[model samples]
Target: MKRLLLIGVLGLALGGCATPKYNYQAVSQNISKPAIGSVNEAYVGDKMLTQGVFMEREAYYVPEAKKKFLLNIPKGYYLKTGEDQKGSYYQPVNAIPDGAAFVGVQSVLITRDNSFCFVDVYFNKVCNFKNIGEKRKISVANDNSFQQTLIYSGKVGSKINVGYREFSSNLARPAFNNDVEYDLNESKTIGYKGALLEVIDANNQSITYKVLRNFNKVD
Candidate 1:
């Protein structure tokens, strides 16, 4: 009798450890297409990674490696839709964007190695492209000053506030001319509201960010 009871307990424990699979049909069918003047948010924990808005053009808010990459969807391209264990997948329809192909779902991993904070991007649910791009340096200061700096103001519920100064730099691979530089002048406390968990950024020296609990609320 005791042996049977032990077996039953073991079975229950294993069942509890099993990974839960979401109903893809129900989830995908309900995904709303981006509306004009509306913002769609994606997150890593409490940090906001991408905040896409549909305006005159589809704008993507990609904050990676302490740098903000606000890219517009290329002309004649639409967002291809899919989802995975990681999160919702949005890739350019039919063709590659900016010469980079989206093989599959995308995810981000944060790692620390001695003096650098690595915001690693994973594609197709795998960490394959570790050295494919140039490593941009970001500086994290211990004190707040007049100079431009990357700052996470705070978070209220699902809204994450971030502040930064205006700056412009050349893309690692400039599409038009190698001599041309992209201007980035978003210097204000912006709030990323709804459907996000974390906001991550790094300095040239260290990582400075906040991570809320792991709550994947896909809406």
Candidate 2:
């Protein structure tokens, strides 16, 4: 009888250790507000540069050979990494940029049926679309000058527009424009890569984006 009792205690202890240290369901229920898009800024030395919107949700931050996996958790969801570990859970609160050596932003879009997270790091810039339905526009600026405008549409057979100009040099000139067609049944991310603007659709289990134009000429 004592042997059985010892075995039961050991089993109970192991089972308790197997459970995650953090409560994922409690964290998910604590998120009372909706997730919103944000821009993470990057700097070279002391000079500030505009690093685009968050694009890649999952990535490894390798700073001086040390690697750490950074995962974006949605507002209403929690992430559990391993078992028998303490504080290995992540819950979304605000924009937490990846890496200690880098300055950037992490943005995520959460709907009733889907969750999309992305990161904008270093010199790479990306634009985010969240709560897209019918027609909506997102504009970012410094001081009073207009910087970039992200237009979104959920209408079938409609087109999304992105209009902006350089704030430093071309402040008075007309903003350049790019347009991408929208599909109601698809979820996508549209942004700039190097010099080209593209739209990525992740609908059919495959992700793809089309280059629209070279926006680098204006830069």
Candidate 3:
């Protein structure tokens, strides 16, 4: 019995260690509330630069290295690394480590509206707008986490204008500007990727929908 208990305890410890740590900062106070078109443009820009600036998932940061490392762990926070290629933060320290692996976003200067937009390596959006982006982090405990609802704009005759969006991965473009028109008389169901929805009712200002199936990735 004692041996079995010890094995269970060890298994729990191993499982805890396997869980990934999230050291993200609180939402940014200055959120970038870009227009819908601007948001679409940002996604396209990210897709274009996917192979260039946001290419490397991880890089080594040496103090003597010619390229300057972009520190993105919020303003007051600090990122610390160990000699064993592991990163952790404790009390504040000044001395820079010799070789540190940078697993966060890459520093890419993207131009947006004559201003430089620092694209985050994670979501490919402006790094400073981390807080605004967190809205997309749906809670797994919520039933709506599996849903991909449509956004209603306006209706004209039999055409209904709606928008669809979903959280994007680092390797792909963010989903945006999926505004499409559906004919109410012809069909009440609409789909994107594998997410199916039934438009029960709609008007110029609002829409009522029934989620037929949860969202799935596009093949």
Candidate 4:
């Protein structure tokens, strides 16, 4: 009994040292046909490794020992829809947005490897990925970041969000660019050199900002 109590106390002490986490919200979605020869390969790793991650903002990291990733989120209670107080797949249990409909959120856990072992996130009816878009392998790993692989920010247009899958049953290749449901500034997004890649929704909108690299310092 004494040993158990000691272990419990240690656990509580260690938990206090851990940083408080943040919530990351998925951007809205939009669709765009890339210019005939444009290829974009960007990821969160570049910024994440350097800036670390913001608690309460959705972010993930691949554990050093494993190639998998960890999704930083609290376990949402099992609920019928986002509006239902019991639980929601559309929003958090404590907070609910109006007009959102989702079944329930299944809790996904991660190990020391920091990788997500289960691709079964899709199986959960409460997931926001109901419109299962295309799957693209983001080179979130260090080796790829060293090579300056482009990571999309998932923002397609000014008011739209284009999201993708990180965990899948099949492994994908690097440098392979897939069709995006939205433009660069719409859905998946990352920031470089204090300038954010703004999602340009109109033909008149320009994406002429330079995405400078500062990963060498972090590397």
Candidate 5:
């Protein structure tokens, strides 16, 4: 048949061509590198500073005055005098606000280069945290959010944005107007009275306290 003749002719032509050879291998270009032990130094030379609002759940002494403002009432609708005091961006909370507990690692500055350095932050005069000096690890999300262990490194004059944490207020339906800062002139820290965050402005004179908010990261 004609089909048989076509197949015979195609086979003869195919036999005349050559087959190419190929190799399967992977090539890496990385050269030399130091061992992990080489990074072992007494310290990474960094400082840790934590900023957050201190919400005292009970009787605690705060240096900042708890201000009370009363609105003018003509009479009768049950006059609501200011029961709670408003604080600065360094806001305040009477007690740990219900659902707003968050922490952020912001900036890390090199404060000491010794074998061990004590880094602590205070809110008002109650909230305080102490972290060991080291390289902290963390996990990050696409939305620029992350959680991690805190680490510190840098020369004496370097500043690194590390982390931040917040304790939001839980006292309303919509749950708005919540802040994570302490009152100005507020001096206090965990079980002791001290300053949490000290901001010497560009003028080198103005001082203010700060609160750590959520949606922050160091990871």
Candidate 6:
């Protein structure tokens, strides 16, 4: 009897350990596309590497090294390095002499071959790229940050309050949060950020609505 009990417990433990597959369909049905080009290639350290753009800056990836580097500095800007009790720190400089180390900002070393390496002050390493864990691989879905979520806060009188949160791929801009109130008597259809929603029914506790359109699918 004890053996049977132990086997049952072990089975339950294994079942609990099993990870369920993520349902992308439950989250969204809209097609996700890559923000960067498919065959973007750039040269870094004499090695041709795949390139990507993030936060309006050029990014390079080293597949074998499993690393990502961002060109955080802009053209015509020089790199400035300083040292203190904290060791080394770097920043971008707007003005410098013609040959006075006019390398991009955030870059620690610009090699004789014109290759660049960024500074990792935490690790005390110079020209080091961002380390993406060995298990993590880059993908379009992961890169797409556009997310829109709507929540119904409650209702006051005849007005219904709805809140919206959005994270768009426009890295240069900030995330958007909005709260809107609509009167049930005015219209059942609601429009937000090019997407439309229809109120089926609602109360102070909860709201029932259907997505007439998804902003992601909007052109």
Candidate with top TM-score is 6
**Which parts of model 5 are misplaced by more than 4 Å?**
1-178, 188-195, 202-219
3 versus 4: better TM-score goes to: 3
| TM value for model 1 | 0.17
User: Local error of candidate 6 at 178, Å?
Assistant: 1.2
Ranking by lDDT: 6, 3, 2, 4, 1, 5
lDDT per residue (tens digit) for residues 1-219 in model 4 = 553353354331111111111232333221122222243333422211122111121223221222112222232221112112222122222121122222222332222332221212233211111111111212222222212223333333343222222211123343443223444443434343332343323222223222233322331
lDDT of 3 by residue, 125-159 (tens): 23222121111111111111222334556778878
Shift in Å, residue 98, candidate 5: 35
Per-model TM-score on C-alpha atoms: 0.17, 0.19, 0.30, 0.18, 0.14, 0.34
Q: Regarding TM-score, does 4 or 6 come out ahead? A: 6
Question: Number of backbone collisions per candidate, in order?
Answer: 14, 7, 0, 40, 26, 2
Against the correct fold, how does model 5 do in TM-score?
Answer: 0.14
Ranking by TM-score: 6, 3, 2, 4, 1, 5
Clashing residue pairs, backbone N/CA/C < 3 A, model 3:
none
Candidate 4 off by > 4 Å: 1-13, 17-24, 31-35, 39-57, 66-219
lDDT of candidates 1 onward, in order: 0.25, 0.27, 0.33, 0.26, 0.21, 0.39
Task: Compose the digit string of candidate 6's lDDT tens values, residues 165-203.
Answer: 654563322346777788989998776666566767767
Give stretches of model 2 more than 4 Å off: 1-76, 79-88, 92-149, 152-210, 214-219
Model 2 is weakest, by summed lDDT over 10 consecutive residues, at 26-35
Angstrom error of the Cα, residue 163, model 6: value is 1.1
lDDT of 6 at 153: 71
